[model samples]
Target: MSDTIQPPFSILFVDDDQMSRHHFARAVSDDYRVHLAQGADEAMVLLKELGPEIAVLVTDFRMPGRDGGHLLREVAQAYPQIVRILVTAYADKDMLLQTFNTGDLFRIIEKPLRMDSVREVLKQAVARYAERETRQQRLLAMDETLAFLAHELNTPLAAISLFARSVENDVAQEYDPQRQREIGAAATSMLNNAQYCLTLISSFWATVHKSGGQQPASGSGVREVRAARLLATLLDSYPFAGLQREWIDVDVHGDFVVHAMPNCVALVLSSLMSNALRALDGCPAPSLCIEVISEPEPEIRLRDNGPGIAPEVKARLLLDPVTTHAGQGGHGMGMIFCNRIMQSFGGGLRIESTLGEGTTVTMRFPGSRGRIRDADGEQASVTRTV
Candidate 1:
């Protein structure tokens, strides 16, 4: 049952007959919150006031002003969430057909209704209401999740744009060894960031399409990803400008490899890099270091020499949206999204920081070091470690 429908669910009984209305309310008052309305006008007033609370509507077919069919149709249009049923003493076949065709009628009870039959019909109506409410809530939740995902991708998209412009600028510069190297690095980084954005977009749309009753093509799942190479790619491609680019170091100690999706890994690293850069805004000797540990568990440690997280903020960092730099336009969904991604890969995210010191974000991939395979069923190795 949906939380919207509390115990002793509400029902609006609308009829012109005072005797019939009172009789029905008295019988069902023990099991439901019965709201008696003399006619369609009174029923409309009650519905306008307590529309969301009322789960079922039982109206007489032949009322004085507006007939039951008209009232049911009005209810269907105004408050479609409510389950509608018509009651009539004159069971005219033509009238019943017209009523069924026009209104959102759930069930029709004849005049002199049996208590047992009414109870069963009400049970079904409540069940139907619950199902519809649950579906509506799920749809609302999905919309919110999609909105959050779009918010999460904004930083990366902006970074990609900046990196692309940098690549163009670096390429147009005078030909020199240093300039050439910088151009090459910038181009590579631009490509990696673009690919990361595409991957996130694809994953998001795939979920949306699946929810909309569309079947997505099956593809390879998690695979052996070289941690050292992945981190290097991320570091090179990250959109860091001016002195910010110089304030970063990469240290790879061992052959770190983990079975995971490359794009997911890229997104997690990108998010961490963005956070580190943002935190290092106004520091004197702002430096960020990424360390890879392969022995105990494949993990990447991102350490930044900047203002650390506050105690209250650190406690619910990944669980909720909390940002120390919200004044600089932070939505606070980056780390939370990263944490969720890590959890999807059978991994976890950990954060440690002191007030005056800095923050260290550890992305732990706890699994055995796996060998990557090529298309020809051959084991491939990444020999580069920085």
Candidate 2:
């Protein structure tokens, strides 16, 4: 690891001739860890053992069994992170053209090995190898992250489909009108759950690689969003079928706000509020309250007087891609999608509940400057997140 005596980049040299291997190894041994391969078969074995470390692969164009181009193509497909360099002495013009078509050769070293040219080409190959290695590592990480997200979303989607079919066949035919309604509602909820899962996946993917801040679609000044004003708007848009206003309170001391993508904040707040109201269904004298707490952190807490989340379901509520009370709805993608939206704006979501008491869902928004700026640079007088 010392810079003064840094080892040379590892090089894999494959040729049918023993003398050629010895000469090449002797020439490069001072700097690089040279591996001599008798043929493509031996080269493959060395490659399998020393992947990322084997920086450059020098293969003769014409070998006994498999030709150089064929080997290089295999290397490119199998281990694209390694740099491939082909050496050919008896290449016809047609074969030379074909080499380019076969694999991405770093540099073609015409054989009748000129030591100086080999040194220069090998140096270039090492540099190319470094670049390729970096790119490959990034691609591998991204692929893994995407795969994990896909797997997490699939479980909920499958459950949603199965439960939806059961509700359609069994509950729909029940004689009781109330039972039928509940069954229909359950079906609708399941479909929403699937949509919610898809939204979380799409939002997280977008936010993970987001370059800049969230910008409003219209590059306009941010509209002031007071918690009180925001709550009124939500109530007007979606009148909670049976709303309880006795404990509802909005205490905005200075003006809680956040810079965001215009309608995004509103949509997020409304969704959270709606979810809270729906969660209170069937509870005794169910009451839903919205309180804007300003100290420590600017946030809106939506509490409901309903049978709180069960212990088992509470454990995986927001963590899992799908979450819903069993038998309530076969689909449970709401909270997960809500979490994604909050994360998009440097915000967070919290859930607090007691089995027999009620559930409280808090959405926190980080404070920005006195006047929050939208993506368009316009000042937002008020900010509200439901």
Candidate 3:
């Protein structure tokens, strides 16, 4: 519910049925600020007017004149940041999968729209939007800080080095004759190195800060990454100590593709690895499984045999990240950032854990392949043998 008394962000619900739209709004208005659009045409007008305020777009699959699929595709082209969700009673996997991949659907809700399920999905959607916004702000701040390092930091350093070099020369010369000669030579060498560094900084300032250009996001151009190849590279280069490498088992039913920045994928894997390793620290015979599946859209799953997370802790962490191991220097930002990254990829991360049993984290990527899973429970995997 955004942990706020007032509704946090706007959710646009588009449906041709008046009863359905009204019921959806009435049920969700307590948790979210709901906007009603009777069809794609009206939805477009509202989006144009209140686009910045809206965080999610939940439209029924069957709407008059332009339909939800058309609306979603148009929105994907224009307002890509808004999370897209589809509500459908259409049991056809082929149609759903096609719309899923094409329209960049963040999630699909089955018809008979249970209010409980709707609320939960809306909460997650809101969280995803918030996390994306937070990440953008951080990126902007990081860019500015980098620019400061390149442009604003050099002048003071130049002055300091100039004066310091002169002072060092004078001190070495005036102090004692023999030692002073040795010291002066050393000081001169240091100054030469400092001058070289300054030259490099000046070059960087000129090249990067010209006209105050903004730096694009890291891996902004990345998409359609091969899961098998990427996993191979990550496992090869990932730092594993002693038997840690052997402890991991990769079950490749078949290679599949994922769409996201390569760096983001690496970052997600690294975080899961770190967390799993920490959880296994005091355990006996630890193991982790990396499952690469081709069906129901390409997916990479990581299952770890470690102390499973408590439900309460998991709940709190999902809502607001706080380190479980703060004493051990954990900042607790890994999973939420991973969640945001997965959302940014047009998929979502699902975590299932039992107290005594190990945890399974599934990373779902958006694509049309094999049989589609149920929107709620685990999907039947139709594996392609390599």
Candidate 4:
């Protein structure tokens, strides 16, 4: 039944024997775009022409001109993506070791291939190809994410550093003893806190990439605190602290505490803030207001006054990576990170927008409060929204 399912990828069979090529093609022809190559030269031509579309390569190890391992190595170097498989008559130890070292071969199928074994190997090849593609995309995503963080945080980081240094310089030069000491201490505190915050951001950037865009299993539980208060504290630490930022204008309409990872909550809130700010860009006196309503179900509505998202943008807001401003770069990993965090905490993200009006992003944790549970019921707690 799975074989009958639509194949989303293409594959190539590169073997000199006519029967072998026919057999491989016939086996996988029902699914996938199967191409056949009679020799290494023909395989090279096919690869160059359809490299991007092809997802896997099946080649024989003992061909007349070029052996399977050599041909596959060349293909791996040239294409890197097409999953390689070596089909040979015998499991030659030396050649097998060489193939393994080459590092792109997906599997080794013995010659006079059994139909079932060949099917299984091809199936695995498809899965491996899918995984490889996913990994590549995630890596590209991490790169984009880092660029975004650098772009968005650069200005604030510079300002914080500059202002803190200026405060110190001014304090040291002041003539009055009491005034000088007071200013010096205050400047020192501010500078220290700024440094700490910068360190945290740097650590977060490293963690995001290190995670491969996956959320860590930090689990769920509040840190002996209330939900709204926790959210407020998170907003307080954001770069726009004390600015005319809209995220600060928030009201908790529910009386509840959440037993969830505080860092996860913070990450989600940060993502919401970032989305709000992006949506509010270019608007006249942009403002964002968050309202937490928990009676029917725990939900935080993040509304903004900036121009609403386009229909297309709204449709793909959660599906695709957020578009970074030209040269204002980012790895587009923030939202995905937030989404993963939410899912890990038994929650999901929702967005509604009206172009030229405004947009709102809502986060809802579906699990019930009082007896919050994860698979094994690891003592999860829910802070009811008041």
Write down the TM-score of every candidate: 0.58, 0.42, 0.44, 0.56
The list of candidate 1 runs beyond 4 A from truth reads 1-9, 175-185, 188-192, 205-386
Better of 3 and 4 by TM-score: 4
> Tens-digit lDDT track for model 3 on 1-386?
45657544699999999999889988978777889999999999999999988999999988768888889999999888899999999898988888999999989999999999988998898888887765664454334334333322343344346556666667645476876676655565445435534544554455346424333343756345578777787677565544678888888987866544444565566557656766766678898898888775667888988889899877766447676765433456556666665555556567878877788887777666334354565664432110
RMSD of each candidate relative to the true structure: 13.5, 12.7, 17.1, 10.9
Report the error of model 4 at residue 254, Å: 17
| Winner by lDDT | 1
lDDT, residue 154, candidate 4: 53
The RMSD (Cα, Å) of candidate 4 is: 10.9
**Model 3: runs farther than 4 Å from truth?**
1-224, 369-386
Tell me which of candidates 2 and 3 scores higher on lDDT.
Answer: 3
lDDT of 2 at 188: 67
| lDDT, candidate 2, at 178 | 79
**Local accuracy of candidate 1 as per-residue lDDT tens digits, 1-386:** 22333443599999888989888987777677889998999999998899988999999988788888888889889999999999989969999999988896899899798988998999899889987865664444344345545765665556557767777666665778887787776666566556656655765565456446322222565344588888776666555555778888888877566554455566677678777887897799999998888755567889998889988989898888877645434667777777766655556578999977999998866455333233353544422110
Two-way TM-score contest, 2 vs 3, winner: 3
- Please give me the total number of clashing residue pairs in predicted model 2: 6
Predictions ranked by TM-score, top down?
1, 4, 3, 2
